[model samples]
Target: MTAPNLSANLLVELFVEELPPKALKKLGDAFATTLANSLKNAGLAPSTAAVTAYASPRRLAAHVTDVAAVAADKPVVQKLMPVAVGLDATGNATPALLKKLAALGADAAAVASLRRENDGKAEVLFYDSLAKGATLAEGLQKAIEAALAALPIPKVMTYQLADGWSSVNFVRPAHALLALHGNEVVPVSVLGLNSGRQTHGHRFEAAVDPVIIANADSYPETLLRNGSVIASFAERKAEIARQLAAAAAQAGADLKPIEDDALLDEVTALVERPNVLIGQFEEEFLAVPQECLILTMKANQKYFPLLDTAGTLTNKFLVVSNIRPEDASAVIGGNERVVRPRLADAKFFFDQDRKKSLESRLPGLAKVVYHNKLGTQGERVQRVAAIARAIADELGGGELTKQAEQAALLAKADLLTDMVGEFPELQGIMGRYYAQHDGLPAEVADAIEDHYKPRFAGDSLPRSRVGVVVALADKLETLAGMFGIGQIPTGDKDPFALRRHALGVIRMLAENDLALPLDRLLNGVFAQFTGVDGFQANPAALSAFIYERLAGNLREQGYSAQEVDAVVSQQPQRLGDIPKRLAAVRAFSALPEAAALAAANKRVGNILKKIEGTVEARVDPALFVEAAETALHAALVEVVPQADAAFDTGDYTQSLTALAALRAPVDAFFDGVMVNADDPALRANRQGLLAKLHAAMNKVADISRLQ
Candidate 1:
């Protein structure tokens, strides 16, 4: 029998064919975490045990420190039936009790050892037993099975084992499985493969056919020394980044690889051994838009495009090779040759696309259906143009109106261009280039591209006034159209990216501090869809949706939820003022009187709500039977003008601060006056006094939310 206290580092590896590059990192992390957590849960490892995860193109491995060979025994107490059911009138065991004991590997002879205890309602018979611990072999087998079952495989592959009779499903066909506790094989199986101490390394650069891991602690070094592979995914990615930077510096001063974490992860997942090499295409291909060339190289060939100090794409790029050769000239030359044709293709698309102006492509949009209920792209463009014109007029019409309308019309035209057809991501980008070629106004050309600004969170808003107007119109049309057709996002199912569109609109308005009212904007955009069938304009629903998105966004920016709710709950029409209002609320919350005032404000609101009808702010001075009421009324007269002046000038912080003086009188009034008095006239007068206080206090925000 294995010693109960025996402990050692454990190693597990699943060797297989290449995994999906995008999903490799997630799979490795999940496998290691799930396996370690299972052992910890089963009491085979301590909660503080250290675990390390490693992934290469062909293997996923884990090393866990200080795992036990056999779990410790634990005591368990199980409740049998009530004492009345377990015993007879003669104080003898019943047959039902005997049956339950038998299932627990006990018999009637053990009845004397049973204990009686109250289980909340009645005295019940309890049985105590020691559960035998699980051996490492048993625990590891379950852990391996659990780990494989929990992998986030993008897609599963089914294949037959070598024996041809058995089959299994995994991310890829399993070639071998390696499991070890210290230096001993743990005897586990997964994906039709038995655990062993051997794993293959790099395809061609490895010094051995099957590298042998002597112990769990030596797995990484052993694989690296004999197999010519870097075992850790993070370490390999870091090495690639270092090499890319060095190569870029050597190529030229101020040159660096484009920054894309996703691309780096994918490249790391595609190789076991990384060797960064410099490759170049003809400088003539640089005439094509750098975006097109850079995207093709990165997306298709997994190459990193180098950029100059000015952020201009250079003729050179970096290639991460899977093998390290003494002479990398052939590899570099082969990459250059392969990329030449791709650049040529980009050039071809650019040349062919420039033959027609963006205005000429406008007719092509009619053939493309945007959404079944929302009409074609051509119609959508018209709606966006109309919204842009109305918004520009609101902001002061002139050249701005014409530029915004022109930009909106030409924005979606490039979606029909050859370059954009090949690369859908180049939709707005290509529009700007083609507009420039067609000799349109620089403002209009820039707006065509900038209208798609803030496509994702943390992205910049439109750069100019025309751009902001057009972007607002574009995003608003999408939101109004989708919400009007009842395609609102529920849960995570935002197929149309309506959430992103809403966020884009919010960011533009708030970040740019545009003077547009949200209600008016939504109504105008919804009005654009009046004649379309199956379109019902619900500006209220759209406004609520935008405000909800704004609330979440504000909270994420580090404001307390109470502060955000206080400002957002009012559904302030001017979204640009949200930041100032939130600042004011936060500042007001720090005051000594803030808490008392908030509670008093809440009390006042509750009292007013209980009344049958609206309580006017007008109060009769003659009805002030209590000094507290008179003092409160006198304080409001002193504070209202100062607060209103600050508020009119957009000094929200000062506006909220001015109300702090009224907290004392307000508290005293609530303490001394009975709002619902026996005299109807007096009670109504008191409520009106409270109403005036509530209105003045809540102008900046609903301070009651701070309560």
Candidate 2:
């Protein structure tokens, strides 16, 4: 009878000083994954073992299920020397063979059972053996060491151990290590701490001094009931979220928490026993921009600001405290007291910033260095204004031109504002507020704020035409200036975020479907850099960079690689037309004749490329000598005009569909007529006929790529 496997659930915890809040979650995840993976690699844990990670402000823990007491023995095959090298004329084992066998812990007697196989050219001998399984104690120690070594610690600190003579580098000072297997303590050591069942919990609110974890399955329950801590990171985060929603609901039905995942994550890492408390500030502080107030609350204090149904910030906010008390008035009052000074400082910055208009800050930008080689922010503003003006003209010269230029000039003026200086993310937002306070045109103010829209993936684009023009110009100027100075992005090293700027430009043009040609816009930007020293003009390289980004963007939008390659390979000047071109390619690919036509188009392109000179796409009917050629020429005469008309009218699908009539003629011509004819006139005429066919087939996209 076969024996059943002996297995158990294992738990490990590392008690330490408070970990860095930003890195706590990642550290917890890395700790659990590395430990589990190492155990699995060592065969001490099943491949399907369940791993649960626990993290609190003062601890990191992991619980793995179905770990074996010892791994099962595995069979191994060892390859030896070839038969010719291992044996002599008498077919007896040589000294080399004896030595190889000895190294494998086998003697000459084992050679009789050796297996031989022809490995390509010659026969080689191999030995088979069973490797002994590793014990759980040894495997667990190795897994713990490896997991500690693999932690993604942002910074390491060296601290002396209790021994006072030795020091270790770690993310934080280590206090205790707890390792348990099933219901028994597993003797293991890490970071100068021995394994134990005791661990400390909440600094002030624990039900017991030392939480006794009875078993691997009881770790979280013990910590919560006795230690007054929620040990699981995910569970604690969800609990905080639930409490926040409930608190917001209690405040008012129309009120809701300002949703920010990053803020929630940061707050989650800051507490063990989360207690939501309500706090309020003076209503006069709302006179400051809500963005300023909210940034102060969220960034400085880690508070969740409440908002009304109209999305307006209220005077009250919720504070997530680590301790729960019968009467929470003191906690709420303490938080309110701590936040009053922060709000007052924000108000002071706002009042000081509003003392001067954005126009007044224009000259100050000349002193701000944007880049050491690219001159000052003032110069950049001028360049952006020039490009915006040109784009405005191309988009339809009118009020847009004036608004775009004005917005571009004032866009960087916010860099000199007190609020923006205090919070760099508030640059554009503060500029809009200041512009409106200065009584500038509403379009100009909105454009200034909207120019930096679509700042990230899935973000909204500019809502106004003036904003679009300025946004395009702003991104273009960055691309042109950076490329001019030879600061091109290489591999993953884009210090200037040039790839993001290129994507922003592409999204603006393609998503907005503006009439501006990409090449023309790039040239306009390059023109603004005239007379700048050390600036090289390489429009083609910059154009290639933008097109590469466009190709990736198209593929991410779910277009097939072939479709994107076919369209982008042509370097279409109007990016706005790409979606239509892709649609046309998709529609054409679905047609019954698309496959044959694409293959034939590829064949035609290869033939035309081999010719010594340009093949004019002008066919002469009189020069066609074969019936196949004459038929193809007649078909072209009838279909080319229809396709051209459809193409001119922007009916790309219809244009490609019209060329489907040439498939039969194309196949017949290739089968019966030789493209490289014996006579020069016949060859030239055939080449012209093929060139005409090629041009018609590829008006929307390079259909040959479909092959």
Candidate 3:
């Protein structure tokens, strides 16, 4: 294939009202990517074309290099119909063929040029033609429409255009549309706006009323110089980050901006020209928890709270202003004034919440519904406390059970607190603080806070044994309750985050190596909801769901699917032992005898599965008539005891390694021995020997999966 030669850089922009700040970056990315993909598919741009996306608060734009003025003509080969159908026995054109030809813009005169070939079953007529290339003007219009339709807009606004009657829907009200190819204007229209070289600059600081982009390559430079707008989202965000660091350095040696990508992106969308200004509030607000002050500043004011070397929140914060005035004092002072009320509200909530003990707030929880089917938070707390106590008993009953019960009881009490009600993200955090203030045990307070640990992937696990117990109980209770009510997760829709809860339980069990059996733990949680109405608990199904999550997580952690399948197929009761089994599988896989033993094990399993009744693992040596069977029996007698001892001691790697000695005898036996012997006694004995070998081989994992 030859490449198209005529190409030029293309620019397209949609100037509109302020876009949704949180979705600005996504919209901009989708706009550029979808448009570029469409143009490439349409042959109007090379697949290798470089695409650059730009987004500010009021505009979304894209610049593509090496876009064709017109797409290359594409050759099309379309199958018509069978020759017998298209032409009669007399070989004259039929009405069907004529109609088909007419639909393709061809007439009878073109029939002589049609190609005929056998299409497997019969001779078929094929039409060969060239599809016309799309002009740049037409292609740009389609690209723009597709890009707009593909944007991840949170919502659409429908507004009347200047025509007064006609209306268009977009993420925001579109005011201008610009399209340029090289130095020429490409005529296209969208959202009731005609494409031109003109677009508005910054609302207050532009040097010109309309920035006239000369060419596609000059869009960013023109906007920066004449429009006083940094057009690129990435460049603007980087600039803000740089300025924030510089400002922090100027303020103190150890100061740094609170690192948050979402906040930075939102602030970037809010400004075209970023001016970093340092602002300060009264240090008295620091008396409140740093998290409250930090959340208020970042969430309400979009300010980056500065932190010291010890990661302590300072009274100073940085503001990203849209304008760069000679004196930044007004901007700084205004930001400081605007933040005072928000900080005071946080302080008030904190103070009011501390007035009452978290224990006293427990009764109020009955007013808050946990789930429609799951009863009130007060009832949910009781269930969690019960589960925690059971788990603590399994781990090591005593002070641990007491602390876990206390923590689980107070865990949901914070939901009624003023601070947590105002900031739900601080649910467990506020609980810890209030528990400490109420003179609760330190471990109890810590457990209350850490119950929600490892909230997401790669998050930390609970540090205390009581915390671990409580966390496991809490997550298991959620799973049991949700699944019991048939609110199970399906596909991508998990309203209750059941997948996350399952993974949390898996992490706690595996990472902590807790001796608790998974089935028993699940059954314990399920047993707690016995008398609750509308509760249809399925312990087996919930266990399956957890195992599924564990399998996926193991795959993500770099374990091969075969190894995971081998270990997980057994449905081991202890999730903590799965890692050891997987490790044993890996070690076994490297041994020279692993392949033959795995294949033999698979064969034995298949043979045993077909048996009508129970096949015991008792081998009487006198019944073994074949030499290979006798050798296999001897090998088992020598190896099974050692492997069993290793397995019993939790040395799975050694257990699996010990079975390597059976490869030679097992292979010879499979090759020589016929399990379906003429005598019933001989057949039964051989089957029994194979069962014993299978049992020994799979003590750690189902080695058949290795096959």
Query: Best candidate, lDDT-wise?
Result: 1
Q: What is the C-alpha lDDT profile of model 1 across 63-113, one tens digit per residue?
A: 999999999988989889999999999989999999999999999888998
Better of 2 and 3 by lDDT: 3
TM-score of each: 0.98, 0.97, 0.98
Model 1, 294: alpha-carbon shift in Å?
0.5
lDDT of 2 by residue, 57-129 (tens): 8999999999887889989899998999988889889899999999989999988888899999899988889
Show where candidate 3 strays beyond 4 Å. Answer: 1-5, 88-92
Q: Could you tell me how far off, in angstroms, the CA of residue 267 lies in candidate 3 after the best superposition? A: 1.1
The TM-score of predicted model 1 comes to 0.98
Query: Which is better, 1 or 3, measured by lDDT?
Result: 1
- Tell me which of candidates 1 and 2 scores higher on lDDT: 1
What is the RMSD of candidate 3?
A: 2.1
Provide the lDDT at 52 for model 3: 97
